[model samples]
Target: MKITVIGTGYVGLVAGACFADIGNEVWCVDVDQTKIDKLKQGIIPIYEKGLEPIVNKNFQEGRLHFSTNLLDGFDQSQFIFIAVGTPSNPDGSVDLKYVYAVAEEIAKNLKDYKLIINKSTVPVGTGKQLRDFIDQKIKERGINVDFDIVSNPEFLREGNAIEDFMNPDRVIIGTESIRAKEQMNELYSGLFKDAEPRIIFMDVRSAEVTKYASNSMLATKISFINEISNLCEKVDANVEMVRLGVGADKRIGYSFISPGIGYGGSCFPKDVKAIINTGNEYGYDMKLLKAVELINETQKAHLFDKIQNYFDNKKDGLKGKTIAIWGLAFKPETDDMRESPSQVIIRKLVEGGTKIKAHDPEAQNEAKRLFKDIETSIEYFDDNYECLKDCDALALLTEWNIYKQPNFQLIKKHLKNPIIFDGRNQYRPSEMKEMGFDYFSIGR
Candidate 1:
C-alpha cells in the first residue's frame, strides 16, 4: 500500500515512519521546508523511545519519503491521511482550519478516487463536514472526482507512540462505505497480522467521540486519584497505600490512578477541554468532567503549596529561596513540555522571587525555551546532582526512570539542607525519615 501523511507533526511523522517500516511506501508531506529538509537527513525534531531508528531505517531503505510539497504525496498515493494539528481555541473548541485547509487542497488537486483518512483527533461529525467541504470545493472547480472520508482517530501515547502504533490493542475506523472499509482493512492488515487486534467498524460520529471519551476518562482517573490524595493528606492517610488497595479490584485495575501534582500533556488537557466545550455547544452539561478539570487545575499547585508552606511560616516564604527541580518534562522518554505542570509551578515560584534550578534527561532544551521570559530567575543543569548544588531543597516533578533511585548521598551533600519535596511519590516516606532527611511527598 502507498500512503501519504500530511503535516509532519508528531502523529503524522510516527504514522508515516511506522507505515513505511511495515513494508508500505509512505510519503510524509509537510508545509515547513526546514522540517522536511531535516526529516530527509534523518534529523528528528521530537524525542520518543525507538522512533528515530525506525524512521531512519525506513528512510534509508527508500520506503519512507519526506517532502514539503503536498503534491509529492498527493500524486503518488491513493490513501491520504489528514494528520494535522487541531489545537484548542481560546474558547476550548478545536481549531479545524488546518484540517479544512488540507481537505480543500486535496479537493482542488483531486483527479481520481482517494481514501481521505483522518488520523487527527477531531470533534464528532468532522468527517461529514470535510466531505461536504470537499464536495463544495470540487464542484466549484467544475471537476468531478470521488473521495471517501474515514475517521481513524489516533490513540498514541507521546512517549510510547511507536510501540502503540505497531501493537495497537484496537483500531477504531469509522466509515459507512464498504469500499472504504475494505481499502482501510487492506492497508492495516499487515500491521495487525501477528496480533489479535480488533479493527472495529462504526459510524463516523461514534468513532470521533471515542477518542475524546478515552482521553477524558483517563484524565478523570488521574484527577480522581489526585483529589483522593489531597483528602488523604487531611485524613492522615497515604495515597500510595490507598492506590494499592483500590487498584487491587479487578475492575479498577491500576493505570492512570497515580497521584501526582497534575496531568499535563498535549492530549489530556486539550481533549478534556474540547469535549467539555462540545458538551456546552450541544446544551448539555458535562458535570463530572467539569469537576475533573477543576481538580486537575488545582492539583497543579499542590506541590508548590507544599514547597511554600515548608519554607514560608518561620522563613522568608518562597522569596529568596532556591529550589532544585529534578524533572521538567510532563513525563519521561519525551521532551514535550506543552501544558507541563513544571510551567505553572516554576512560573509561580519565579513570580514570588524564588529561583529554580532544574534538570531533566531530555527536556532542558524545551524548558529553557518555555521559561525564557524568566531566564534570569532559573538555571538549568546537565547533572541532577549539580542542579541541587546550593539549592534550598529538592523537588521531583517528572518521574523519569533515572530519578527513581538516585544518589541520596550526593543529594544530601549538594543541597543546603537535607530536604526533599517529591511530587510523583517516587520515594517511600518511611525510608526518607530513616535516612535522616526531611522529605515531603503527596498524600503521605
Candidate 2:
C-alpha cells in the first residue's frame, strides 16, 4: 500500500513512520522545506520515545520518504491521510484552516479514486463539510473523479505514540461507503500480524466526536481527582489512599485519576475547549465539561499557592528566594511545553521575584525557549540534583522515570533548606517525615 501523510508534525511523523515500518511505502509531506530536509537527514523534530529510531530505520530501508512537495505524495499514494494541525481558535472553536487547505489541495489534484482519511481531531460534521467542499471544487474544475472521505481520528499518547499506533485498543472508521470501509480495514490490518483489530464502524459525526469525548472524559477525571485532592487536604485525608481504595472497585479504574497540578498538553486542554465550543455553537451547553475546564485551570496553580502559603509572608518575602524545579515539561518522556503547568508556576514565581533552577531530561531546551523572556531569573541544569544546589527547596512538577526514587540525602544536602514540594505525590508522607525533611505533596 502506498500512503501519504500530510504535515510532518507529531501525528504526521509518527503515523508515517509506523505505517512505513509495517511495509507500506509512506511519504511524509510537509510544506516546511527545512523540516522535510531535517527529517530526510534523520533529524526528528519531536522527542517521542522510540520514534526516532523507527523513523530512521524505515527511512533508510526505503519505506519512508519525506518531502516538501504535496504533489509528490499525492500523485503516487492510494490512501491520503490529513494529519495537519487543527488548533483552537481564539473563542475556543477549532481552527481548521490547515485541514481544509489540505483537503482543497487534494480535491484540486484528484486525478483518480483515493481514500482520504482524516487523522486530526476535528469537530463533528467536519468530514461531511470536507466532502461537500471537495465535491464542489472537483465539479468546478470539470473533473468527474471520485474520492471517499473517512474520519479516522488518532488516539496516540505523546510519550507512547509508537506503541499505541502499533497496538491500538481500537480503531474508529467513519464512512457510509462499504468500499471505503474495506479500504481502511486493509490499511490498518497491517498493524496486527495475527489478530484482527477492534475497528469500530460508525457514522462520520460519531467518530469525530469520539476523539474529543475521549479526551474530555480523561480531563473530567483529572479535574475530579484534583478537586477531591483539595478536599482531602482540607479534611486531613490522603488522596493517594483514597485513590487506592476507590480504584479497587471494578467499575471505576484508576487511569486518569492521578491528582497533580493539572492536565496539560496539546490534546486534553484543546479538545475539552473545542468540545465545549462545539456544544455552544449548537445551542447546547456542556455544563459538566465547563466545570472540568475551570477546575483544571484552578489546579494548575494549586502547588504554587502551597509554596507561597508555607512562608505566609507577602510577595516581598519571596523576592530573593531561589527554588529548584525537578521537571519543566507537562509530563515525562516528551519535550512539549504547550500549556504546561510549569509555565504558570514559573511565571508566578518570577513575577514574585523568586529565582528558579529547573531540570528536565528532555524539556530543558524547550523550557529555555518557553521561558526565554524570564531567563534572567531562571537557570537551566542538566542534572536534577545539581538543580537543587543552593535553592530554598525542590519542587517536583512532572513525574519523569528517573525522578521517582531520587536520593533524598542528596536533595537535603543540595538545598539550602531540607524542604520539598511534590506536586505528583511521588513520595509517601510518612516516609518523608521519617527522612527528616519538610516535604509537601498534593493531598497527602
Candidate 3:
C-alpha cells in the first residue's frame, strides 16, 4: 500500500507513521519545506507519546518518506489522505480553506484512479463537497482521471495517539464505491488480521458527522459534570460522592465525569462550536450544545473566583498577592495549551493585579509564549516547588502525575499561607484539614 498523507500536523503525522509501521510505504507530504526537512532529519514537530520512535524507525528502514512536493507522492500512491487543520472561526464555524486548497491541489495532480480519503475532522457533507470540487476541476482540465472520496475521520487522543491508532476501537470507511471499499479493506488487512473485525462502513456524510458528534458528546459529559459540581457546591453536597454514585451505573461508566475547571484542548472546544454552527447553518439550533459551551466557559473561571474569594475573606483579595500555579497545559502528558483552563485562570488572576508563579513539566516554554503580554506579572519556573516558593497559595490546575502526591511538608514550608485551591481535586479535603492546611477544590 503506497499512501500519501498531506499535512504534518498531529493526525497526518501519526497516520503516516503508523501506516508505514504496518509495512505500507508512506509519503508524508507537507506544504512547509522546513517542517518536511526537519521530519526527514528525525526532528518531530509535536510531542506525542510513542510517535518519534516509530517515525524514526520507519524512516530509517526505508518504509517511510517525507517530502514538500504533493505531486511527488502521487506517482506511486494509491491513497491520498487530507489531514489538514480545520481551525474554528470567530463565528464558531470551521475554516475549511486548507481543506479546499488541498482538494484543488490534489485535483490538479491526479494522474490515474486514486482513493482520496478525508482523514481530517470535517463537517457533514464535506466529503461530497470535496468530491464535487475535484470533479469540476478535472472536467475543466479535460482529463479523464478518476478518483473516489472517502471520509475516514481519526479518533486519536493527544497523549495516547499511537496506541489508539495501532489498536483502534473501530475503523470507519465511508464511501459507496465497492471498488474503493475493497481497496481500503486490502490496505488495512494486515493491521486488522489478528483483531476482531471492527471496520465500520457507512455513507460519507454519516462518517463526517460521527467525528464531531463523538467529540461533542465527550465535551457534553465534562460540562454536565461540571454543572452538577456547581450545584453540589451550592447545596453542600460532595461532587466526588455524587460522581461515584452516578458512575456506578453501568450505563454511564465513569469517563470524563470527573469535575474539573473545564474541558479544554484543541478538539472539544472547536468541535462543540463547529457542531453548533453546523446546526445553525442548516436552520436548526443545537440548544444543548450551546449550553455545554457556555457551561465550559463559566467553569474555566470557577477556580479563579475561588481564589479571589479566599483572599477576599482574608481582607486582601487577589491584589498584590503572588499565587503559585501548578500545571499550564490543558491536561497532562502533552504541551498543548490551546484553550487551556489554566490560561483563563491565569489571565483573570493577572487582571485582578495578582502576580503568578506557574510551572508545568512540559508546558513552561509554551506558557511563557502564551503569557508574553503579562511577562512582568508572571514568572515561569523549571521546578514545581520553586514556583511555589513565597507564594500565598498554590492552585493545582492540570492533574499531572507528579502533582497527585507531593511533598506536602515542603509545600507548607514554602507558601506564606498554607492554602491550596485544587481545580482537579488532586487532594482529599479531610486529609488537607488533618495536615493543617486550607484546601479548596471543585464542589466539596
Candidate 4:
C-alpha cells in the first residue's frame, strides 16, 4: 500500500515509520519545509526510543520518504492519513483549525478514489464535519472525485510508541462502507498475518469517542492513585503496598496505578479537558472528571508543599536553600516536558527565593527552553551528582533509573543537609530513616 501521512508530528512520524516498516511505501508529508528536509536526510525532529533507527533504516531501504509537496504525496498514495495535532482550546474544546485545513488541502489535490483515515485524536462527529467540508469544497470546484473518511485513532504512548504501533491492542475502523473496510483490512494485513487482528467497526462518532474515553480513563486512574496517595500520607499508610494489594485483584490489574506527583504529557491533560468540555457542551457536567482534573492540579502542588513543610518545621524555612531535582521531564524515557509537574514545582520553588539545580538524562535541553525566563535562578547539570553537590536538599521529581538507588554515601557527603523529598516514591521511608537522613515521599 502507498500511504501519505500528513502533518509529521509525533503521531504522524511514528505512524509513517511503522507503516513503512511493515512494507508499505509511506510518504510523510509536512507543510514545514525545514522539517521535511531534515527528515529526508534522516534527521528525526522528535525523541522517541527505537524510532530513529527504524525511520533511518526504512528511509535507506526505500520504504519511507519525506516531502513538503502535498500533491506529490497525494498523487503517489492510495491512502491518506490525517495525523495532525488537535491542541485544546482554552474552553477545552479541540482546536480543529489544523484538521480542517488539512482536509481542505486534501480535497483540492485529491486525484482519484482514496481512503482518507483520521489518525488524529479528534472529537466525535469530526468525521462528519470533515466529510461535509470536503464534499462542499469538491462541489464548489465542480470536480468529480471520490474519497472515503475512516476514523482510525492512534493509541500510542510517547515512550513506547514504536512497540505500540507494531503490536496494537486493537485496530479501529469507523466506516460502514464495505469497500473502505476491505481496504483498511488490506492495509493492516501484516498484523493479521500471524493471527487475526481484532477489527472493530463502528460509526465515526463512536470511534472518535473511544480515543478520548480510553485516554481519559487512564488519566483518571493516575489522578485516583495520586489522590489516594495523598490520603495515605495523612493516614500513615504506604501507597506502594496499597497499590500492590489492590492491583493483585484480577479485575484491577496494575497498569496506570502508580502514584506520582501528577500526570503530564501531550495526551492525558488535553484529552481529559476536551472530554469534560464535551460534556459541558451537552448541558451536562462531568463532575467526576472535574474532580479528577482538580486532584491532578493539586497533586502537582503537593511536592512544593512537602518541600516547604519540611523546611518550615525544621530549623530553616527555605530562606537560603538550594534544591537539586533529579528529573525534569514529565515522565521518564522521553524528552517531552509539556505540562510537566516538575516545571510547576521548580517555578514555584524559584518564586519562593530558592535556587534550583536540575538534571535529567535527556530532558535538560527541553527543560532549558521552558525555564529560560528563570535561567539565572536555576542551573542545568550534566551529571545527576553535579546537581547534588552543595545543595541543601534533593527532590526526586522523576523516576529516572540513575536516581532509583543512588550512592547515598556520596549524597550525604556532598549536600549541606541530607534531606530528600522524593515525589515519585523512589525510596522507602524506613531505609532513609536508618541512613540518618530526613526523607519524604509520596504516601509513605
For each candidate, what is the lDDT?
0.92, 0.91, 0.92, 0.89
TM-score of each: 0.98, 0.98, 0.98, 0.97
Off by over 4 Å in 2: 193-197, 313-316
What TM-score does candidate 3 reach?
0.98
RMSD of 3: 1.2
Where model 4 places Cα greater than 4 Å from the true spot, the runs are none
1-444: candidate 1 lDDT, tens digit per residue: 889999898899999999999899999999899988998888998888898999999999999999888887686698999999999999899999999989988998988999999999999989999999999999999988888999999998999999899888789999998999998888888787743257888989999999999999999999999999999999999899999999999999899999998999899999999999999999999999999999999999989988889888657788899999999999888899999999999998888889999999999999889998999999989988899999999999999999999989899999999999999999988889998899999888
Largest TM-score belongs to which candidate?
A: 1
lDDT-better candidate, 2 vs 3: 3
How good is model 2 by TM-score?
Answer: 0.98
Q: How large is the C-alpha RMSD of every model relative to the true structure?
A: 1.0, 1.3, 1.2, 1.3
Estimate the TM-score for candidate 1.
0.98
Report the error of model 2 at residue 290, Å.
0.4
For model 3 the local lDDT of residue 82 reads 94
The model with the greatest lDDT is 3
Per-residue lDDT of model 4, residues 264-342, tens digit only = 9888999999999889888889998999999999999998998998888886787678999999989888889998999
- Ten residues in a row with the worst lDDT in model 2? 310-319
Across 1-444, the per-residue lDDT of candidate 2 in tens digits comes to 999999899899999999999899999999999888888899998899999999999999999999988888688899999999989998999999999999888988999999999999999989999999999999999979988999999999999999999999889999998999988888888898643548888889999999999999999999999999999999999899899988888798889889999999988999999999999999999999999999999999999998888755534467789999988889988999889999999999899789999999998888888888998999988888989999997899999989999999999899998989999999888899999988899987
